[model samples]
Target: MFEPRLALASLSGEADAEWARAGADWAGAAVLGGVCLDRSTREAARAMVADRDRSEFLPDDPITFVDDQLAALSGVDLRPGINVRSTTAEPVREVAAVAADHDAFVEINAHCRQDELCAAGAGESLLREPERLEALVAAAATGADVSVKVRTELDGVDLVAVARRVEAAGADAMHVDAMDSEARVADVADATDLFLIANNGVRGRESVREYLEYGADAVSVGRPSDDPAVLDRVGDAVAEWFAEEQSPREVEP
Candidate 1:
């Protein structure tokens, strides 16, 4: 499968046309528009369980805003947010509709470390709730393409089991937050056939190659986005690696 050499970091409430255009021009790959859903707040969390209008809850509707932003950002498509904290079948359907309307993809967020999410059963906390995770995946899949971005659960949870469930749910891909360890990443890749995108503390080209060698289909670097110089360095490293991989091998005489 083809893997993205570079994917713009999730912008979160920054899904404006300018941000999208900047991301498209700079990254030249998929752009995950920051975050859309807000289940972090106490009131928002309560409203979700009660099935109320959480649309006006967040600073802005990233799903609705992304449609216009994506029009400006030609090369990159949208990856709308579905934070596990407040996500329900209803809002998820709306997010999916926005994605479809703009020809974008849906990304289920299970990696955020926000305290509110942990308190309200969202983000990494949801990883412990396999049944709920399954339901979330099934709901998110109602869009064009569904991809779940999650953190590695090394405690007692079985990564393989989760990966299988995700794949079985017909998710397009799985983004694993491999953190800083290569060994942990290898273990996650051993568990599933779905395309794996590695994240967490990846800073340079060498690190990117290390993850790929560990069986990652793609590597996501976040810190580089804030610094143009770092971004350029990473971009160059990726280009060099790809060029070398495509270079002709010398024939033995």
Candidate 2:
């Protein structure tokens, strides 16, 4: 069995630095900065360029954040955000440019619940329009590694179909916001063979185990480090799990 990988869901470049200081092992792991599509948010993020403030703040611009994250976490791989709307093509190009420039992976954002994002034809709302979603993935995949982030819903839209369409559109991976259910994860895993990174409400080792069993290729965690001890414990748990799995089986006497 392959050892599971862990990624820190960084809200900004500063948050990425904090995760590194918190003893996160970044080798072969990813550091994903949140979506940075808004104007004001972009301005603030730009001001914080090279500024290492660990204080809480909003998400940073995907481009700028990815650049800094690549430098800060040199050994780790970078996956930047790319929250695009259903109709627009401008943001698609911008996100693709950033991904190419930084030599980083681009993740299409469809999991954010912000009202402005939804009203602007972005975020989870994009999941409702399969054709548009396919187009966005197609356009994004043209430049770099493109992954789509989607939330699992009970009714509204058909997520399985969406996953298949995204995979067919040449997306390198699928970031499934499972919210809190292994069944939803299994649904996504069953729908496509694309690399799946399970997110949302993943708090500890047990939750990670459940996601892995459901066929997740990786897991992302956020805010669990609010308690330093919890961060250490989680890291140890992950390392222990990998160590034990890597150990060879004992031979019979």
Candidate 3:
């Protein structure tokens, strides 16, 4: 029903059907699951079927995997966002089409720091390779809204430049995980017009409001969102804040 001023960032295997359903009404937008299209997810899925110990946090169905979750979200009028990992533009349009079909948002997984993902030239590896990220965002359908998730403070990476590049490459929004320096969110927002979701270490509504004040369009809770109560508190806080900001003011005659 809304564009998710209060949101839940992607949390691999933990973010799924039951979790999505539990926080359905609380999170204006919820990333259904993490879908990685790379050597890592491929290995994980294969290992999953072989009963081996692996990440076990990947999309098996890839294309239609989140359809059920998206359907459940649609039942509640919540917007669905799918966080995905890939090393190439080969599947960007296909994935974008799936998200567009459901009116959901396709978020590029440039935030993951897994070793295997980086080895495969996906995830944070994209931070070092801006050209590839540009190709992926460019491959997204023109009308499909795309979000690029990236980590800040990586060695040798110009985060501000990365944000500007993604925005220029057609990413409508950015999910910024300011691992150690939360100021990077505002820095990026101040430097560009990209709608930003301030992420990392967000504990409550106060942090949410802080990020919003710093220029984020929204704030996202990841690990803490596993508990439904957190979403409840943040949702309630956002409602109160929204009212205050929208309330009428007396004219200064």
lDDT of 2: 0.62
Instruction: Compose the digit string of candidate 3's lDDT tens values, residues 1-253.
Output: 2454877888866777677667767777787667765565566445444574544455556766656656666676567788878776766677787778778888888877766667777788898999998888887736378888899879899988988898898988898888868778888888998888888877777777877777887778898877777877777767776787789987999
Looking at model 3, which ten-residue stretch has the lowest summed lDDT? Answer: 47-56
Best by TM-score: 3
Off by over 4 Å in 1: 1-4, 14-17, 33-57, 60-63, 74-85, 248-253
Show model 2 residue runs off by greater than 4 Å: 1-4, 10-23, 26-31, 38-72, 75-87, 225-228, 239-253
Residue 230 C-alpha lDDT in model 2: 53
In order, what lDDT does every prediction score?
0.61, 0.62, 0.76
Q: Is candidate 1 or candidate 2 better by TM-score?
A: 1
lDDT of 1: 0.61
Shift of residue 64 alpha carbon in model 1, Å: 2.4
lDDT of 2 by residue, 40-76 (tens): 4344334444364423234334456555655565544
Candidate 2 residue pairs in clash (backbone atoms < 3 Å): none
Q: Each prediction's TM-score against the native?
A: 0.79, 0.73, 0.88
C-alpha lDDT of residue 176 in model 3: 89
